[model samples]
Target: MTSAPDMTGRTLLQVIPKLKGGGAERTTLEVGAAFVRAGGTSLVVSSGGGMVEELEQGGSEHIAMPVESKNPLLLAQNARDLADLVKERGVNIIHARSRAPAWSAFFAARRTGTPFVTTYHGTYGAKTAIKRRYNSVMVRGDAVIANSAFTAQHVRKQYEGLPYFDGSRMVTIPRGADLERFDPASVGEERIRPFSLRFGEGFKVVMPGRFTGWKGQGVLIEAARLFREERPDVPLRVLMAGRMDEKPDYVDGLRRRIAEAGLQGVVELMPATDDVPALLAASDVVVSASTDPEAFGRVAIEASAMGKPVIATAHGGSLETVLDGETGYLVPPGDAEALAKALGKLHALGAEGRRAMGERGTQHAGQKFTIEAMTTSTLLVYERLLGQKG
Candidate 1:
């Protein structure tokens, strides 16, 4: 097979904490693959994870490093190593996806006289001066790319006195969902049957978030309990599909709660999988029950793009994505009663009403949330940066 085009003439290095499965990681992979597709070189430096294989398959180079460490000594080492890579590879630019790596990439790009770009994916709760300082690298890039309009506002509000953000170096290129992977047409009815099988032909209500308490999996379980109590004949099932990441005890607790509430037969817990499009397609109503503000509810966007109605908590990007009572419903965060009420209304929506809502969701997704739109807007920002560099 032909290798990814040599990027020697136009090399870019992407620095992140690790090649993990998050929005920033996914975006990094996408940009790297896109760069390779466009006959440019893309190199990623990180403490490698599952995405390493995908990066190599996509014809990009991977350099394993302890880039995620917060210790000052490790960061200094990263800076030196990154600068060496930048100089040796003739990297034209350095894009950092997290703060720790941004700290190293920033200085490396500077030492090599290469452009430095950063994406402010979300806000991290700062508890101390050092914490704030650690977060500053995210804004210090030559061009700071904010992933959402809300994040752009936060960046400005936080760095009010910073000069670059005076509308010149700051640009908002919203994150996007992979429509090709998430499209309803891509998943057939037969493939969707297993998800329904778990619920025994019930109206499948699914909450697709990591199995953490903050993700409100417990609240969703409670909501399912309420739904079953009220409508025993509706044949309802709640599927919690996500990796019990960083919190196995919480997952166990959810199981205990499920049993305590006598929902063992009504609720199913599934691990994270790549079959999100199929899950969304099979779902009667998709839920995003993050008790906290999600930087952005990608699941909501993907579900909407697939013409599925979503019920997300009314916080963070969900407010911007879900049109309350129009495309989908939004309830108060962490309120299972309100969640149950919203799901009740969604279930009450017959085939025609649900179809109409799904249509509206798809229209919104097509207009605002596709990968092409996101990529095109980002390219505009890059062109502006390159032009200014020239």
Candidate 2:
């Protein structure tokens, strides 16, 4: 919590669309909390969600506002509102996390003469010119922070015309998980036992992501069917754990497929929960079968940190997080047969091999994905930005 060298009393204003229970929102909370702990005032402005309580718990200030509005009139009003908030709070820097809020925060910071910083959380699909312009705010940060090297590459690719986006200025600060929360010791074995019981005494494959099609739920289901066909005695169960963030109809379709495939006993759908660590703890193999690449697979890193082998699609952050053949395996995206083959290889590994894989993964995660490392790199960004502003 101590101030990084050269950062003492500057106030930072973090602007996010909302404090949702996701990686981007969690990062905002952690960075703001770190700032506060470092003897600097940190204030967050967002529409607000479940993590608002966590922000407060960390002794940071939060203001509720509809920062996600894209309507021109609403955006103008948001700019004024943000300007007032910045001035009133004596904010020295404005850190925007999403495009919607970045628009308002950009102008507000400009009006207030405050430094504007942004994080490229993912590749925002921009099919239209207008959308592309909106998405450009992420790269427009006086200091842009990318969650992964993949994200940084995407940013550079997206802004190829803008020659000013020096790769050095666009920092890659990997997301960090609370090691204590994700540690095997922190989660209760008793709590995880029921989950194991639910899957029966067999190999458990867990995919924790929203129920959206892009998350590759269908791919996972197909893999499960293939696995079952090859080894009926494997007792393989696929745990689909994530909230239905969008497209409820898709979720319905997924359930119907499970039923039609006669996978009632083999597939279970669970809602999002705070006990993600425990769920990961209980899972024998964690799979991130995202069809579309993720910016940074926080779940993959967390599972690895907990000494759990992960089988993720060989794309996006998964490529960085999972040490294929050692920590886990990575099959081609949407390749159900390949995924099935990887699963079979993992299943074939006896307890000792699995344990060794898990140990290597844990060691890698601890070395590369520590909270301290993330915090330090982030603080360095802040220090450099403040220096430029000063």
Residue pair clashes in candidate 2: none
Best by lDDT: 2
Candidate 1 lDDT, tens digit per residue, 45-123? 9999999999888778999999999888988889999998887887877889899888988888888778888998776
Report how far residue 388 has shifted in candidate 1, in Å.
Answer: 2.0
Q: Considering summed lDDT, which 10 consecutive residues are worst modelled in model 2?
A: 1-10
In candidate 1 the C-alpha lDDT for residue 244 amounts to 70
Candidate 2 lDDT by residue in tens digits, 220-251: 89998888998988778888988865678888
Q: After the best TM-score superposition of candidate 1, give how far the Cα of residue 194 lies from its true spot, in angstroms.
A: 2.3
Report how far off residue 384 is in candidate 1 (Å).
Answer: 2.1
Per-candidate local distance difference test: 0.81, 0.86
RMSD of each: 3.4, 1.7
For model 1, the superposed segments whose C-alpha errors exceed 4 Å read 1-8, 162-167
Q: What TM-score goes with each of the models?
A: 0.93, 0.96
